[model samples]
Target: MLLAVTRQHEVAANWDAASLLADGSVSPEAGCRELPGCWGLAQPGPGPGDRGPCYAVPAAVGPQLPDGCKAPRLVCQLHFTSWPDFGVPFTPIGMLKFLKKVRTLNPAHAGPIVVHCSAGVGRTGTFIVIDAMMDMVHAEQKVDVFDFVSRIRNQRPQMVQTDMQYTFIYQALLEYYLYGDTELDVSSLEKHLQALHGPTAHFDKIGLEEEFRKLTNVRIMKENMRTGNLPANMKKARVIQIIPYDFNRVILSMKRGQEYTDYINASFIDGYRQKDYFIATQGPLAHTVEDFWRMVWEWKCHTIVMLTEVQEREQDKCYQYWPTEGSVTHGEITIEIKSDTLSEAISIRDFLVTFNQPLARPEEQTRVVRQFHFHGWPEIGIPAEGKGMIDLIAAVQKQQQQTGNHPITVHCSAGAGRTGTFIALSNILERVKAEGLLDVFQAVKSLRLQRPHMVQTL
Candidate 1:
C-alpha cells in the first residue's frame, strides 16, 4: 500500500490514485484487525511481496490531522519520511570528500536532488554551502568559505554549529579554490593550511612581486660616509676654498704659508701670490669658453668649488676641471668670512652631475672623492626603485675610496629631507655594525631640531 503526507494539498493531488486504491479503500473507523491482507510487523515486514496491498497507520495523531483519517497514501510508491535528526560531526577530510561527492552526484541528474541528513539544517546546510561554493569555483567566481558560511547562517540559523565545522569547511574550500584540487592533495594543501595557522596569514602575498618592485623603486640609499678635514701639512696647503667671484670669476683660497707655490702654479694658477689668497677671474664671465681655462690657471687649485644653484655654464666648467684634477668640490657650507652675508656655496655642477650620473674617479687616483649630504628637516620621498640615487651614491663612494677623501657631500632638492634621512640611516646602520646599537631615533631627532622633518617614513 502507498502512503502520502505533506504540508501542501497539491502534493496529495499528484499522488497516483489508481495504484493507491488497488486494494480498495477502507473506512476511517475500520480497525487494523478488520483490514484485509494487513500485517502489523514492527519492522518494514520483509519487502513488498510479503505484505501486499496493506498500509500501516502511525498510532499517534496530532490535532493538526483529521480524527477519521486513514493511513497516509504513499505517493509514487516512494516512501517519503520526514528528514531525520542527526548530528553531523565536523571532519575536515570527510567534508572535503562529501563536497566532491555532491559535485559528482549533481551532474548525473537533470532535476534537483534531495539532500538531507537528520535535522536537514546542520549537515544539509553545510552540504549546500560547499556545493554552492564549488559551483561558484566552477564558474570562475571568487569567494571565501568563511564569508560564504556567514552569509548562509544569516539566512538560515544554526548552519555551522561549531568552530571546528567552520574550520573544516574553510580548509576544504581553500584546498579546492587556491590549489585547484577537487580531492584533497595533502602535500599541496598543507603548505597553505599551515599559513592559516600563523599570524602572517592575514597578509596576501599574491601581488607581493608588484609590491616589491614598487618598494625597490622608492628605496633611498642611506649609506653615506663622511669626508673629514684635509690631511695636515700639505705642500700646496690643500686649496679647499673656491668661491665664485660673480657669474664667471671665482676666488681661490688655500691655507696660508704652505710653501707649495711651484705646485699650484704649474697645475692651476698662471699668476703667483705669496699671501695665499687670489682672485681667479674668467674673461667676459659670459661668451668666453677660454675663461674656464683661464680660471684654472689663476690659483692652480686641484678642486673647483661652487654652489648647487649656479648656472649651467659654471657647472660645465667645474665638470671640465674635475677630470683634470681628481675630484670637484660641491655642496653648501656657511663660514663667517664676514659677519653680515652668509656665504652659502653649492657647486652647481656637482649637483647636476651627481643627479645625472654615478660618482666615479680615475683608477690612478689613490684619494677617493666621497660626497656627503646632510639634510636638516623634512625627509624627502623617493620613488620605488630609486636607481638614480643608488647609482649616484655608489659613484660617490667609489670616487671617495679611490681618491682617499672623507665626508661625502649629500643633499636633496632643498638640501634636507631626503638628504638628512639618508645620512641618519647610514650613520645608524654604521654605528649598529660598529658598536652594536640599533637605535637611531634620538640621533635623528637631534638632527631634526637643527632642521625639522628629517625622518624617513617607515
Candidate 2:
C-alpha cells in the first residue's frame, strides 16, 4: 500500500514518503545509504514526468533492526511519481499500468508485504483496498467494495483518508478487472498439470460429445466454403486443403504486375483489443515461402511466431526459407538475417526484410521482422508440457507490446491444430483479464467460423 508521489520537497523531507522512495536524495547518516546512486536508480521511460520507475535498495543501508530480528537483505522499491498526494491520478489506466509493473517486479510469495505512504493512509489505503479486492476478485469472481473497505477501516482507523480516494479504490478495481490486469490464484500443482496436459477435462466435453454425435454439422461446416478471390489454379498450393475453409482465410490482394496470384493459406484471428491481432497460417512449403514473405511485408507484421520447426520427427514441417547467414531472395522479397539466437525451447531471429517495388524509383523497402521459432512443440500433437509454451508466448507478447501492436503471423505444420490452440489460449486469457471470466467454447467456436477445425480438441 504505497501512495503516489506528491510535491518534490515532501520527497526530500519525508524519508518514508512514496516520493522519497522514487526521487529522494542520498543520506550521509551512518546506516542510511545515499539516494539515486545507492538505489541504482534508472528511469524506465515514457517518463518525462513520473510515470514511475523501479529500483533496488540495500537493506543494510537502512537503519539497524532490533537485535535478533530477521530482516530482508535487499529491498526493491517500485515508486509512483504520477499522482499528487492531494488528488487521485489523472487517469486510472496510468495507475493500473504502474501497478502491473510493480507486480512484474515482485511476483507472489508466502509472506506479508510492507506497504507505506508518507502519511501511511491516504494513497496507501487506496492501494491496499484495490489490491485486496483485486485478489478477492481473482479467488472468487466478485467483490463487495463497501464491506471490504469497512473492514480495512476497522483495522486502520481512517484508512482511506478521503471520499475521492475511496471512490478511486472502486474505480481502480473495476479498471483492473475490466481492462486487463487479472491475477489468478492458480496452485503450482494445477499449473504443472495444465503445462503437461492441455486443459482440465471439466468443460465443453459434453457439448463436444454431442457435436461429434453427428457425422458432420452442416450449419457449422458451411462457413468454411466461402473462399474469396481464391483462383482454381492456386488452390493446390495450400498445404492442407480441407482444414482451411474459404470464408475466414486471409485474402492477400494482388499488386500490379505481380507474377503469381495473391493467395496464401492464412486467416485472421482476433485478440483482446484488435480484431485481426494475428494471422494464423500454415508453415510455408518450398513454393509458398516467397508468398509468405510477401504477406509479411504487405501486412507490415513485426513478429512471426513459428510453432513448428523446419523438420520434426523426420518429416518436413516447414521450408527453411530464411537464410542461415546471408540474404535470400524469395521472388521480390529478400530476407537477411541481421541477428539470431537459438535457445533450448525457442529461437529468436531478427530479419532485415526488403521488399522490391519495381514500379517505384527506390525499388527496395526494408523492415525488421522478428521470427520466434518454437522448437519443442510436436507437429501432430500438443507439447509434452506447457511451461515452455507459456514462456514462449509471453516473450512474443512482450515483444509485440514493445514493438507496437501489429498483426503477428503464427504458423505450424498445417496451421490447423497447434496453431489454432495457441491463438485460442492467447485470446481466452486476454478475455479473462478484460472481462473476468472466459468462455472457451465461444472462443473456439468463433475461431472455427474464421478458420475451420480451430482448437482441434474440446
lDDT of 1 by residue, 1-458 (tens): 22221111112212232412222221222212213323232223233421111111233212223667755422111122221122233223334433443344344434555654333344456666766877877787766677777888898776755454455456667655543432223345456445435544335453322222222222221221011112321221112221121211233333258432112111111101011221222111222223233333332322222212212333321122233233333221111111112212112222112211125353321221212221112123443454444444444445545644322333333323454555455444443443343333333442333332344344
Q: lDDT of each prediction vs. the true structure?
A: 0.33, 0.64
Predicted structure with the largest lDDT when compared to the true one: 2
Summarize candidate 2's per-residue lDDT along 1-458 as a digit string, tens digits.
22232333343433443332222221222112224664342222231322221222212223346789776243444555555434576346446655665565564762455665555566677777777787898899898888987888888876777777778887777656643532333334355435435432555444345433321331345444545224652443444443455645666667679743566778887665566888988888887787788888888899999888788789888888799999999988889999999877899999998877767556348888899998877656678998887788788889998888989999887777778888878876664554354544445555666676765654
Give the TM-scores of the predictions, in the order they appear: 0.21, 0.52
Model 2 ranges off by over 4 Å: 1-240, 243-247, 255-260, 358-364
What's the lDDT for residue 94 in model 2? Answer: 45
**What total of clashing residue pairs does each candidate reach?**
64, 6
Candidate maximizing TM-score: 2
Model 1, position 113, has a per-residue lDDT of 52
